[model samples]
Target: MKESITRYQFISLIILFEFGSSIIVGLGFEAKQNAWLFILLSMAGGLILYGLFTRFVSFYPDTPFPQVIQILAGPVIGYILVWGYILYFLYISARVLRDFTILISQTILHETPLFAVSLLFMIVVGFACYLGIEVIARSGELFLPYVLLMGGLFLMFVFIMDLPKIERLEPFFNIGVKELLSLVFPRGVSFPFGELIVFAVIFPHLEHPLNSFRYGVIGILISGIILLIISVTILMVLGPTIAMNSTVPLLDTISLVNIQGIIQRMDPIVIIIMVVTGFFKITIFFYGGVTMLQYLFKLPRRKSKGLIGFIGLLVMTVSMLISENIAEHLKEGLEIVPLYVHVPMQMIVPSLLLLLLFIRKRKIQKK
Candidate 1:
């Protein structure tokens, strides 16, 4: 709770978190070969949504999101809203944990119990959360370069093998104005970009809050660009239909790398990216939930140590119980969660908070 992170660490964490399960599942594939365009428009929407989130934080830059809610909404209403976000964060942490669990069970550990994989992964995540935000941020700073290198290598090998078929992207503008715009708003922006709302907790931990906010925006832009490149690569290589249909398009793309057989079977690279980025994603969500609890109850640093471990178990259990299988999980995430959960927590509530803050500021000025 007493920890402080550097600006570089903040940017690295944002990039790593954004690159989480979203990359594994891919985004904007509804546009088919022109999924890149879909992603581009979504990133624009995400940036605007992010500006709204950060603007709310700017009113109370020194405070964490939980406290900001209390100040803006008053204790009764803020208490309810803060608790909602707390559960929301933990629920999402569980969801992402389930995401990696399914990926590992399907790809690497076919025979392994999904519960076993989640437990092992959650152990490391729990330990990291126990350490605090500074440690998490530092780990992200250390790993961001490695992630970039591995991601770059994957892209490089695809071209080296001459796999991309630019022709697959023919009739590029086939998407209607309505269809493209439909995908961009709630679906495209919500999943990865709107998820940055969790960073409101982490933002208050930064050593230089004002400057670090700028880095965070830059981090989102960089992640968006990386996502765009990956989307285009998948479309070019696997074509629109295949990329859209595949559960893990990037993994499928990497599986196609065959250079004289020696440079093939690069599934490990995708797995590594999934594990590393998923860790950051789940841990950040976990941390946000725990941070809210700590702030709510006024828990000391000593008490939060136990809370972290307890919450970790809760998240793991909820992950398994959240859905019947991967199909159900993805279905809920795609259709139900965005409209029902994400819009309220990420967009509606925050927008309302901003409005309240504006009124409060004017009243204070009048006084």
Candidate 2:
């Protein structure tokens, strides 16, 4: 209920949130060499979509996204719509946790069970949620600079170690146009970009709320550049073939950071980037969902504290049960999530809601 976050903090939060899982996954691998191209295009699509979503917010000043939904649609249908977003926020928070847990188990803690890794991570995530968004946004402002600095250094090392082959990106349209375009449609946009909807929940908390849209756009722009740099770096270093095939292309790309034998075994750099960004990412989504719950159920923050813990527990459990294995998880993320959940909840529903907003405005004008 406090509008405490500054515009710069909002930008930092978006950079970290968009860069969270996105840096590790969804690197435009499917498009191969053209992955970065698709990402750039996807970003443009996302910006326009985001602009529209924010416009919806501008209509209802001093309100959260859920209240906007309530205004556009009546309470009954609006609550149903808001519930869809609540589930989405919960799903993505858990999914990001699952990704971190999986990566840790596969790499550092090979002997650790998925549950244990998740358990440890959730403890930190839950504690952050307890502190709430102001603390989380402050943490982002403090840490995102390092993430970006480290990311820049990593990119520089890749280029300095050995120049990536220009030929790797040859045959420009490597994949058929349809195939490449398809990869960007809902999946690419939703994962990092469309997911900006969650920010609407956080946006209402911004002290200079009028500057919300500006910072949000800047956030997307900065994150897009980062994501683009990462995708292209992967393509240039690993080439399209290996980059496309590797499950953790960014890590794999970082693994190649052999700076004249001075900076080998740079796995820790990747881990640092992942953990810091992932923390802010999870915290924001978790907080957003919790705040929405308080609004939806009309619960006080004091009363909702227990509910937050319960939902965090639910996130851990659901993440564990999401898929039998990482392969299935990736497949579901690529095919199912975009097609069904994100497209409807993020893109489609928002469009419908915008139309409804217009209709409501006209009715009011007549009054």
Each model's TM-score?
0.98, 0.96
The residue-by-residue lDDT of candidate 1 on 1-367, one tens digit each, is 3579988899999999999998878988878866888888888888888888888656676888898999999999999999999999999999999999999999999999989999998899988877788889999999999999999999999999999988988987998899888877788889899999999898777787766557877998899999999888889999889888899999999999999979999999989998899999999999899989988889875667778888888999999999998788988988889889999999999999999999999999999
> What clash count goes with each model?
0, 0
Best by lDDT: 1
Question: Model 2: which residue pairs collide?
Answer: none
Off by over 4 Å in 2: none
Which stretches in model 1 have alpha-carbon errors above 4 Å?
A: none
All candidates' lDDT scores? 0.89, 0.83
Per residue, candidate 2 scores C-alpha lDDT tens digits across 104-129 of: 88878999999999888878888887
Q: Report the Cα lDDT for candidate 2.
A: 0.83
